[model samples]
Target chain A: MDHDSYSDAYLKGVLEDVRTIAVVGASDNPLRASHFVMKYLGDKGYTIIPINPGQAGKEILGHRVYAALSDLPEPPDMVDVFRNSDAAAGVVDEAIAAGARVVWLQLGVRNDDAARRAEAAGLRVVMNRCPKIEYQRLFGEIGRIGVNSNIITAKKRPVKPTKKLI
Target chain B: MSEKKSFGFETRAIHAGAAPDPTTGARQTPIYQTTSFVFDDVDEAASLFNLQKVGFIYSRLTNPTVAVLEERIANLEGGIGATATASGHAAQLMALFPLLSPGDEFIASTKLYGGSLNQFANTFPRAFGWKAVFADTDTPANVKAALTEKTKAIFVESLANPGGIVTDLEAIATIARDAGIPLIVDNTLASPYLIRPIEWGATLVVHSTTKFLSGNGTSVGGAVVDSGTFDWSKDGKYPALSGPEPGYHGLKFHETFGNLAYTIHGHAVGLRDLGPSQSPFNAFLTLNGIETLHLRMERHSTNALTVARFLESHPAVEWVSYAGLESSKYHALAQKYLPRGAGGIFTFGIKGGYDAGVKLVESVELFSHLANIGDSRSLIIHPSSTTHRQLDAEGQTAAGAGPEVIRLSIGLESADDIIADLAQALEKAVG
Candidate 1:
C-alpha cells in the first residue's frame, strides 16, 4: 500500500472499524500534540488508552495511563505513534507485538523501512498522517474551520455525529 | 484530504467549503446564527483555547458560517486557508498584520481603489506606524527599486480598480521571491473567475467579497487567502508566523500549523483583538452570491466590453481606459492575466472635464449614482467628486481618477440598454 496517500474510503473504513486507540508518546501538557489528539479522539467517542512512561499508572482523560502497549488490559484496534521518525521504528515493533490491527504515524513522522516491516507483518500501515485530521476531513468537520478538507461530496453527512461537536 | 484528483472551478465554486448539514441534512449552507458554541466539558474547551484542536469557541475568533465562506474563498483562490473579515479594509489590515510590525514597510501599487490607496498612504502609516511605499507597479522595475531592508511584502491589485491596468504578476512575483518576501495581491476586481493571482505566484490574495464575489452589493465583507507556499521560517522576518507567539503560550504558528499559519494567526490574533469578524448572516448572503459567481462574471465581462466599446467611439468621450478594448495600452497585459474578460469596471474621460463627468453621473437613469460597485445593477461614479475627493489633484490623477475621469461598474444588464443609457447621458453632458 502507498503510505503517502490513502483513499477517503480507506481512511473512513479504518476510522469506522477502530473503536479503541492506544496513543503512544502521549503527553500531559495541554500544549503537546499527543495530549490534544487524545482529547479530540476521546471526545469523538473513541476509547483512548494513553501510553506515556513518565505518566504511567496515572489517569489521563479518565483512562488509566500505561507505560507500554503490553501493559494494556486489551490490545487497541489502532496504535497511534506520536514519536519522532527514529522512535517510530521501535514503536512499530511494539505495535505488531501488541497484536494491533493498524499502525498510524503522526504528521512529519515517516519511516519507510518501519512502515514496510509493519505492512509485511499483516498490519495496515499509514504514515505521515494524523488520525484526528483524517477523521475531521472525511466527516466534513475540518471544513467548518476553513481548512480545505479536499473531500467534495453532495451527500448529506450522517445526522448523528459520531462524536461531540458542540 | 486525498490528492487523487481535483474538481473543476465551477464544481468547486458550488461545492467547496460546503457539505450537507450533518445534523439536519440541509443541502444549502445554513447561517449558523449564534454568538458562541458549546463545549462538552472543560478539557475540550481548554483544547480549543490552546489551539491544540480545531473547533469553534467564539464568534469573534471563528464562526461556523464565516468559516464556510473562508474555506470557499480559499478553495476558489487555490489558497491553503483563508480568514473572512467585516470589510475589505479589514481584510487589508489582516493581510498586513502578521507581516509588518511597527516601523516595518511594504510596497504597494499607486493604482488601487481610492479607499485602499488612502488606507495605505494615509491611515496605516499614521495610525500603526507601518509605512507603505507607493510605487508604479505597472513597470515591474519600479517595484524592485522601491524595496528596502525593512520591506516585508509587495502589494498590488491583480486588475487595478478604476484604471483597469493589469499588473505583471509573474514578474512582480519573481521580484518578491528573490527578496525572500511574500507578494500580496488584492483580487477584489478580478475575481477568481477572471484571474487567480496565486496561480501566477502570489503568496497571499485578499478580496473585498463586498464586490464581485458577493456580486450584488448586498454584503460588506472581505477575505485574506494564504497560498501556503511561502516559507515563513527562512529569514526569521515574519516573527508572527515563524517565531513563538506570546498569547498562545509561545506557540510558533509556522511550526505548529505549517501552511495554515497566516490564516490561523489572522483569526486567532487579528480577528480576536481587532474585532472585525464577518457576521454570520453576511457570510450566508455572500455564500449564496458566490454560488452563481461564474455565471455572473461571464455576463458582467461581456456586458462591460460592450459598454466600453460604445464609450470608446463616442465623440463626447476623451479616452476610454478599459483593458477589454484593443485600443487600451494595457490590453496585452490584460490578455495575459485576465483572458476570461477584462472584468466589469473601467474608467473613461469625458469631453467637458470635471463638470461633464459630474453631469453624466447625474444624468444616467439606468445606472445608480453610488459609491459602491460589483452590483448586478449598472452603477456610475465621478471619483474626483466623491471617492477620490480627499486626494490632491496629483494624487487623484496618478491613481487614474483625474478630474475628467468617470468610472462605471457595468452590471449584468442588457448590452443595448447599457449602451443607450450611456449615450443619452453623454449627449446631455456634452451638448
Candidate 2:
C-alpha cells in the first residue's frame, strides 16, 4: 500500500471498523498526552485497554490494565502504540502476534520498519498520528484552531450508525 | 517558527502566533473585521456547532485576529492556551466564570485595582450570586483563614496596582494547592516580562492588555493564560470543567480536552454567553504592542525607579510606596517576585493632603492627568478623587489610595526630564 495514498476514505473506513484499542505504555498521569488520548477515546464510546507492564494490575480511568498486548484475553481491533519510536517496533511485533487488524503509532512516534512489517503482515498501519485528533479532523473538528478543513456546511451531518462487533 | 520554544522572548513576541498570510502573503496578521463566518455547507456548520470541528462561526466567540493575540500571549506566558476578552474587567469575569457558580465563593486580595475591588466586593455578589471574600493577602494566613467549603478559587495580583506592592505568590499558591483550588493571578502590572505567575505555581494568569501589554494604552483588552497544571477532576469541585456541561450538550471539557479544558471552556461557554469578546482590531494593536514589551518594561522600570527615588527625597513628599525603594515594606517581596524591577507605577504622599494631590495633577507639564497607565507618555492621577472615589475613606487607604496620595505612571522619557517635570509640579503643589 502506498503510504501517501492513505486517503480520507481509507482513514475513515479504519476508524469506523475499529472497536477496541489496546494502548501500549499507557500512563495514569493526567498531564501525559497518552492519558488524555485514552480518556478522550474512551469518552467517545471506545473500549480502551491500557497496556503497561509497570501498572499491569492497576486501573487507569476505570479501565483494567494489561501487562502487554499478549496478556489481553482477546485480540483488539487496533493496537495504538504510545511508546517512543525506538520502542514502536517491539510493540508492533506484539500487536502482530496478538492478531490485531491495525497498528497505530501515536503522534511523534514513527517507525518506518515497524510500519512496513505491519503492512507486510496484512495489518493496516498509521504512524505519527493521534486517533483523537484524527477523529476530530475527519468529523470536522480541527477548524476551531483556525485550520481550513475545506468541508464546510451549515447542516448537521447525520450520525453514522454503529454496529458493535463485541 | 519550527523551533518555537527555543526562540528568545523577543523573537517569540514577534513571530509566535503570527505567520505570513498563506494566501496573500501579508506579513502582518490581518484584522478579520467581519462579525460572522460563512460555512461551506450545513454539515460543516453543524460540525462547528457540535464542537465536532473547530472553526469560526461568530465573532462573539472567536475571531482570527484575536486568536493570533491569544496564541501569542499564551506562548509568551508559557501557557498551554489562552482566551482574550474586551477589557481587563471582562477578563476577570471570564477567568472566574468557569470556576464559580451560584453560592460558590472565591478569595480575592483586598489590594486590587479600585474598579476590581468594587466589582469583586459588590457586583459579583449582587449580580452573579457568586460571593468574593476579600482577604488581606499581605499575609498567607489571612488567605488560609478565608477558605471555606464554598471556596472554589483564590485570586491575587502579582503586583498591586497604584500601591506598587508585590505579592508573595508562592505562599498564596501553596495555600491554594493545599485547598484543592486554582490560584488565579492578575499579572496586568507585572506582565510576563517582569514576572510569570505560572512559574510560581499559579494555575492561571490574567492580564489587562490595556496596560503594559499594549504599552501604548491604546487598546482595552485582556487575556487569561492557563498553565494547564491544576487537576479539575481531582474531586470534581469544579463541575463546569470536570462534569457534564449542560450548555454544550453535556460534554465534559476536562475529560475531552484535558489540560486545555479551562481555556476551551472560557472560549466556548464564557465568551459565548457573556458576549464580551475582544474586537480583532484591538487584538491587532495589542499584538503590535507586545512585540516591544521586553524593551518597554525594562525602560518603564528604570525610569520608575529614578522617579521613585526623586520623590523619596523631595521636601513636599511625605512618603513614597514604590517596591523598588529599599525603604518600602514590599522591597523583599519585590526582590523575590520581580527581580527585574518593581514596574512603572507607584504612589507618593503629598505633605498638603488631597488639595495638594489635586494641585500636582493640575501642575504636571509633560505628564497627562489621566486614569490610564503603561503609556509611552507619562500619566498622573489623584486616585482618591478620581479612580477610588467610590470607595470609603478606609477602603481608599487600605487600597493604597490615601487622601494625600498621588499616583504616577512613569513613561519612556529621559530620566532627568521626567524628574525635572515632577520637581516643578511638586514645587507648585507644595507652595
lDDT of 1 by residue, B274-333 (tens): 889999999999999999999999899999998888888899999999999999999999
Candidate 1 chain A — worst ten consecutive residues by lDDT sum? A157-166
Model 2 TM-score, 2 decimals = 0.79
Model 1 clashing residue pairs (backbone): A166-B38
lDDT of 2 by residue, B1-431 (tens): 13122567777777666666555667787989999998766755665675644568899888878887887888788787788999999999999998889999999999999999999999999999889999999989999999999999999999988788789999999999999999999999988999999999999899899999899978999988889788898897988899887876677888666666787788888889998989999999999999899999999999999999988999999999999999999999999999999999999999999999999999999999998988988899999999999999999999999899999999998999999999999899997
Structural similarity to truth (TM-score) of each candidate: 0.92, 0.79
The numbered model that scores best in TM-score is: 1
lDDT (Cα, tens digit) per residue for candidate 1, span A78-116 = 999989999999999999999999999988799999988
